[model samples]
Target: MNLLNMDAENRVVLNVGGIRHETYKATLKKIPATRLSRLTEALANYDPVLNEYFFDRHPGVFAQVLNYYRTGKLHYPTDVCGPLFEEELEFWGLDANQVEPCCWMTYTQGRGKFGRVSVTRRGAHVTATYGDMPGAHRFEWVNPNS
Candidate 1:
């Protein structure tokens, strides 16, 4: 029997950033051409001490990412920033478009230690700038409604 099609006896365990998760290959194979699917295909090595496949990533965020595959719904974590969560979603080969509009606004226009930002949010439309002043370093216009 192919490992991908393994039954109850073929359960796989994943250890992501010190967090252990038990899942079946079948559940992971739900979405093809993704990191999880590839990991499933590669037949990741099992850790004797942990008894799970080791993956170095954010455990808190991975929980949300895993839910996407399981439920086909992308739910962003409130505790994580939009950019970082988006990066993780990209790594998982998931579309950022699936995220909610409110999630996008979490980092649309903001100031940080590196630079300043000016954001214009008109309803669901968003225009943003990054740097010391508006239109300084980076400029982006996004219309989530469209």
Candidate 2:
């Protein structure tokens, strides 16, 4: 998600639901310039209208997830970016690697890292969970007409 913030060191804040989800940033460093340039070239041709609000310095990470969301595409080659996701897994480092085909949202309230929140899918929508919370929510891809 695109956000406005003053960045420093290894951190950024995601503004979700009006509250700043102030937390650490997992943005990749040391992006290999050559491969990134190729990805950029391929991306410009695809975006006829330039609508994606890319949050990465280059589109590698965002593009990986967006294509997964947009057209159910996967394994689009992260040759230079393989290290990026590995970096994210560093904190998830000790935690047991849960089976994939799951949804997880992790954030923080203060100094502590909140573990990934559980998620469930219902039809075309997704629901995230916080244990024992009274209310639960899901966001369906909005289609004015189905």
Candidate 3:
């Protein structure tokens, strides 16, 4: 069989921060020149006993990274801070600019000259608080359901 056919059948296990993930080798190959695609070159991260590669990285963010490989659509994970997500993307050799437009605002949120702004949604209202200082700016608006 050709290498492409063989790679499609090959499976790879990745343990990221104690989370185990299984994916086809061909999926990783979708994005060449990436850390996941060049796993064989990183012998130090391989675990022979479990037949899996181990990475001492954030598991939550890694999920999004792996999804990008599988779907070719990168998304921002809401649970992670923007800077942290950017850092994870850099480590995985993925471009942060590839984040989907739908998530771009959430991904770039809290990154401003003033400081971080925490936003919360309640029913039809959206509330945003900027910093925790004594007279911090707080805004609340009703989001009309279209």
Candidate 4:
């Protein structure tokens, strides 16, 4: 095989929610025991015709997961709900504890609330609720410095 063809053979293509992401196979192998690293074992998700693996998951979140494989740092995506992100992490055999310290608070927000009064920051909306409350309250914070 030519140099370019040989190089392409070492890359992997992941189709997450119809979004295509390509990366080196060695990158996925960096994190042993993860779903990505074990892609060969999961024949059900592979598409031979397309030469890619399909995942019916959030594409935006999958970008972050792929990023974790490329870079050893895992940063929380603010656009995704905390619980949803945690679920994705679990499915990929990643530990939430590995989340960077800067994102820990946002990553854990609204987690373990169990109907207690808790505030969740999601983009422009801040949702707060009281235990067994009738209605949820939404508040937006304005930066004084800005």
Per-residue lDDT, model 1, residue 68, is: 73
Clashing pairs in 3: none
Evaluated with TM-score, which candidate comes out highest?
4
Task: State candidate 4's TM-score.
Answer: 0.76
- After TM-score superposition, the amount by which residue 36's alpha carbon in candidate 4 deviates from its true location, in angstroms, is 0.5
Top lDDT hit: 3
lDDT of each: 0.69, 0.33, 0.86, 0.82
Ten contiguous residues minimizing lDDT sum, candidate 3: 107-116
The deviation in Å at residue 83 for candidate 2 is: 2.4
Candidate 3 residues 6-106, lDDT tens each?
87459899999999999998899999999998888349989878889999999999999999999999999988777788888999999999999999887
Per-residue lDDT tens digits of candidate 2, residues 1-146? 23533444335332222333232333321222222222332443233253221222333433443233234333323333334443433322211132123322221111122223577765655666543334433334433343
Candidate 4 regions off by >4 Å? Answer: 110-146
Could you give candidate 1's per-residue lDDT for residues 66-101 as a string of tens digits?
A: 887778776667776566776777877887777656
Candidate 4, residue 120: how far the Cα is off, in Å: 22
Local accuracy of candidate 4 as per-residue lDDT tens digits, 71-116 = 8999899887677888889988998899988888877664543235
Could you tell me how far off, in angstroms, the CA of residue 40 lies in candidate 4 after the best superposition? 1.3
TM, every model: 0.61, 0.21, 0.71, 0.76
Rank the models by TM-score, top first.
4, 3, 1, 2
List ranges where model 2 is wrong by over 4 Å. 1-54, 87-146
The weakest ten consecutive residues by lDDT in model 4 span 130-139
By lDDT rank, best first, the candidates go 3, 4, 1, 2
lDDT of 4: 0.82
